[model samples]
Target: MEEAPKTLAHQIGGIQNDALRFGLHGVKSDLVGSHPLDVAHRSTIKTHEDMKRKVLANTYGSAFPLKMDLDRQILTRFQRPPGPIPSSMLGLEALNGSLDDFGFEDYLNDPRESEVYRPQDMHHGMEVRLGISKGPVCPSFV
Candidate 1:
């Protein structure tokens, strides 16, 4: 109930600029999702549309018929960071067998993910690992 305004307030407010004003949307006086917006927007909703629907329903009331085309364009523009990032890491974990294991390795090489971790068949001019820790996070585990 708290989120309804935050998600679509801009769109709802935009109603003034356009023609059809749906009722006032719920302003995000508080969190109404699986997570908070700062963290949720990053960790939870992975895509623009996902964020849009989540916010819209939380903010205003309905997900149908956004206020205007510009709203949609803005919503669609945001995108998840490259898949190769998680894929590269998860791929290793998944391959390690059943321990910290889950997810598809193919996903790392998937077009959606960056090409840094290219398909086995593909060749790269260079291979550089970034932001990876050399030692285990948990000393005991290492």
Candidate 2:
């Protein structure tokens, strides 16, 4: 008689089976809906990058790692439902201005916000003060 193959789950007392089930649940959760800004991938990287820089320039260079409210506006524009691109979002001039100035204006301040502006770190002397000067620049991978 031929013996049946044992699953890793059986050998490990069902832990592997539990882990696989957990992973499948996570995948199912992802399929339930598209996440905000996921539609941005349909746009070219050049479009996104230009949009990001335009955003930063208008915010006087303070908008990188965008805040929640700004994130929502970008999401809404990219996910516009089955229609022509909005007139306000349609030209070279639009790219030169902030979204707030162009009619998609809901500038809600996020309840959780942090300042991202920092002066350039021109000196290497701080490395010694932080006790990291002696650390390996790249640790040996092996």
Candidate 3:
């Protein structure tokens, strides 16, 4: 490829930092005209230098530790549901201090009002019952 004649333009910003551009050219800076604007540029140059140092520190200085982290494996245990509380632990429980003993002598709370049907109370299974529908039982058609 043939290269064209290059023209230098005064950059408004201090320095251009691009990987591709830095790769192609060494480093680009446009503090041209050797009049030495030292007083005006001293702060700007210091700021740029500080930024460059910070970037270099972050990029090169702060690298992954050379020591292999092979021992950095974290071992996590599998949690399981706890077993049933023992008889001794029952009394120690905060919610229910002690369990009540349940018993049924007659089994029925009141035999007089019991709903169980006896032989004398039987209706001879004469109650009319509806058959199951084969089609949809939607109420919209009805």
How do the residues 1-142 of candidate 3 rate in per-residue lDDT, one tens digit apiece? 9887696654322233322222222322343443467766787977875776577567767442221122122111222222222123432232222235343523546333345412221121111011121211111111
Report the CA-based lDDT of candidate 1 relative to the real structure.
0.37
User: Candidate 2 regions off by >4 Å?
Assistant: 1-29, 35-37, 45-106, 113-142
**TM-score to true structure, per model:** 0.15, 0.17, 0.18
Give the lDDT of residue 97 in candidate 3.
Answer: 22
Q: Which residue pairs show backbone clashes in model 3?
A: none
Error of 3 at 31 (Å): 28
Range of the 10 consecutive residues with the lowest summed lDDT in candidate 1: 120-129
Best-matching candidate per TM-score: 3
Name the better of 1 and 2 by TM-score: 2
How many clashes (backbone atoms < 3 Å, residues ≥3 apart in a chain or on different chains) does model 1 have? 12
Q: Report model 3's TM-score to 2 decimal places.
A: 0.18
What candidate 3 gets wrong by more than 4 Å, as runs, is: 1-37, 62-142
